[model samples]
Target chain A: MYPNNLKYSKEHEWVDLESKKIGITHYAQESLGDVVFVELPEVGAEFEVGDSLGVVESVKAVSDVYSPVSGKVTAVNEALLDNPELINQDPYGEGWIVEMEITGGEEDLLSAEEYERLIKEE
Target chain B: MSQLKRTPLYENHVKAGAKIVDFAGFAMPVQYTGIIEEHNTVRNQAGLFDVSHMGEIEIKGKDAGKFIQKLITNNLEKIEPEKVLYSPVCYEDGGTVDDLLVYCHNWEHFWLVVNASNTEKDLDWFNKHLKDEQVTIENISDNIALLALQGPRAQEILQLLTTFDLNEIRPFRFKSIDIAGVDCLVSRTGYTGEDGFEIYLASDKACFIWETLLEKGKGYGLAPIGLGARDTLRFEAGLPLYGHELSPEITPLEAGLGFFVDLKSEHDFIGRKALEEQRAQGIPRKKVGLEMLERGIPREGYPVQKDGKEIGYITSGSPSPTLGKHLGMALIQSSEAEIGNEVEVIIRNRAVKAQIIKTPFYKKEDK
Candidate 1:
């Protein structure tokens, strides 16, 4: 189940509003079988919504993690540099790839309910 | 939506929670638990693979030996009955048609296991050149099923069902045996370099054998592997996959499988002239191994660069489970293929550093 507190992107990324935590959704991790490498955006890197901030490489495929809100990256989870599988273990918790300070006004990212509907419709 | 063909063991794959994907018009499992897990299982213990999607074609008659010798690059006369020979079937111009295994039963019957995607095309090519009235070719792909039990413990796991001594079957040797009352053709042959057996039987009885083998092999850590680990294992063992290392535009010499090409043999084949010309003039592009020094994983079609110029591209690459490194096989200019050369792989538009290293990232001991 998608977390209720997080804002979702159509590309299967999730963003935590209060803590500004960002990571891929559980569905995204499942679809990309066996995370082997995670390339996170460096701290202080700036990007707009829909910009490719980082990438997640799985055994089967590779996908870019798009930014959900325009922000300057404040932090990156360095643990994933050695162990990329934390994303598979906890996509919403320890798997958080980046923390950013939202710069501009927020974009109309999908709600958890809307994301669920989108997945079901797919 | 339901048009994809399913193998006889489709239900078993679904029951095991396999991730199914469309490959060669067949709904095949790409992974069961995970690629790395299944791959390490095959390296350390044992893993079973549903290779039934491979096409099996039988060439029979008095002229079978002569026709087969003309079709493939390897010398057919060197192959004995109850033995296996790996060869690359080529077009008239020296490009690969398909890399296959020829199981020679006798001068009257020869079985070839070809790539699934090339079945129809290969059959057409075979018939179009069938000038020998004494020979006949039949596509028996739909009637048979293939199972590969591979690993260090493959012999131990396979000995549970059959009364025949598995030790007598040497590498590349095969025999007819009865397993659980069903007749089967068991061979000590596998894509993985590990010691194992490849069994072929009637398609209808595939599920029963699959389930029974898994049940019997439960103690030996036999896991049902998929196409993901199959590619990784074969790649690590330096095997040339049909579509990856060998293609319509790729010759066996450039793919680093020249050992199988019998250029000096007395028999002449379809691509002999072109291959002889290549041997005399020297090969242009050749396959080489690369170990990524950077963080990115090199994938197929990623351009291999040198001094800001495109030299070649990757053919097959993965995070090797056995070696625990991001490795790749690239076909590049033969001039830069020497060991210890440095190259760059263009990953995500950024050039990542990689080092050319010795091939066969993994090989079984004394194997």
Candidate 2:
């Protein structure tokens, strides 16, 4: 279920409204099946709204995780390097991939209701 | 180009919350519950699989055995009725046509279970090779459906549904028995490297048999497995999938299946001359297993390098669910495939360190 407080990208990533934290949505993790490994960007890395931030590897395939908004990465969840299944277990809370200092492109993200509609259409 | 085919258990898979995907032009379940969990279940407890999409060809006639023996690289003379033999049918150039299982009923009757994607092609190839031999090859793919019950607890779970003595069917042997009133050809065979049985029955009875097995084996932790875990299990067991390990471009000998090829036998198989010539001239490449010493996961099509030079590419790779180690199989230059040799696998264009290791990453202790 899409939470009401988070802003989501069309690419199935979510950015927290208050904390500016980024992670994949529950729908994204479910589609990826079992998460075996995840590659996170460094803290100092700067990226545009559509730039790829990292990768999530499953047993069968690999998918790229893209940044939802333009910003500089302030912190990354290092625990995911050892326990990537956390993404599948808890995609919204403890499985958060990175926290960023927002710079621009916040207006492009969809609200929870809008994100829910978008996934249903897909 | 046409609509994808569906097996009899397609609705059952959907009702079980399976993720359906296109496999060999058939709408098949990739997973249900999850891949790693289903994989571990098959290794430890019991798992059921609806493999009805696999192709079945019945060869019947007085020359059936001789005709098949001339087509495959393995010696079938060693096997008798109720025995199963695995072999690779090859092209005259020594390349693989397809690897299949031959279930023998007698010298004049046998069933060939082949890969789904190669059904039409295999039929054409077999017909093309038909000369003066008194053999009639009929494609019975639509008439037969396959179900596999695999794991350490398979026998105990399956025994609950039938009164037949499963112990009488030893490894590589089969029996015609009745399970829940459905007549079935039950074979002590599996691809997961676990103790299991592959049941062949009428296509119409597939869903009934599948449901009965699940209901009866539920107490034993029997879950329906999908194609996702099936690949990982077979890869971990070092069993070759057609497109990856054996193909028209890759031979059984090069794929490290030389034991299945008979080079000195009196029968002149289709590819015997070419395989013998390769043996005499020395095989150029070989399949080897690799374990990652670095972070990146080795994946199929990733370039394998040694001493900064490209040697080969990963054919099949994944994390071994049972062992919890990242492992892969690669076909590399034979000279560079020595055990203990460190190699580099290019992951996302970055070289990651790995080492050659002995294959069959997950082996059952009882075997």
Clashes of 1: 0
All candidates' chain B TM-scores are 0.98, 0.99
Which ranges of candidate 1 are over 4 A from the true structure?
Answer: A104-107
Question: Model 1: per-residue lDDT, tens digit, B185-279?
Answer: 99999988799999999999999999999999989999999999999999999888888899989999999999889998688888889989998
Q: Which 10-residue window of candidate 2 chain A scores lowest in summed lDDT?
A: A57-66
Q: Per-residue lDDT tens digits of candidate 2, residues A38-114?
A: 99998999999989999999999899999999999999999999999999999999899999999999999999999
After superposition, which runs of candidate 2 have C-alpha atoms over 4 Å from their true positions?
none
Over the stretch A25-92, how does candidate 1's per-residue lDDT look in tens digits?
Answer: 99999889889998888889999988999999987688999998899999999999898999999999
* Candidate 2 TM-score, C-alpha based: 0.98
Q: What's model 2's lDDT at A54?
A: 96
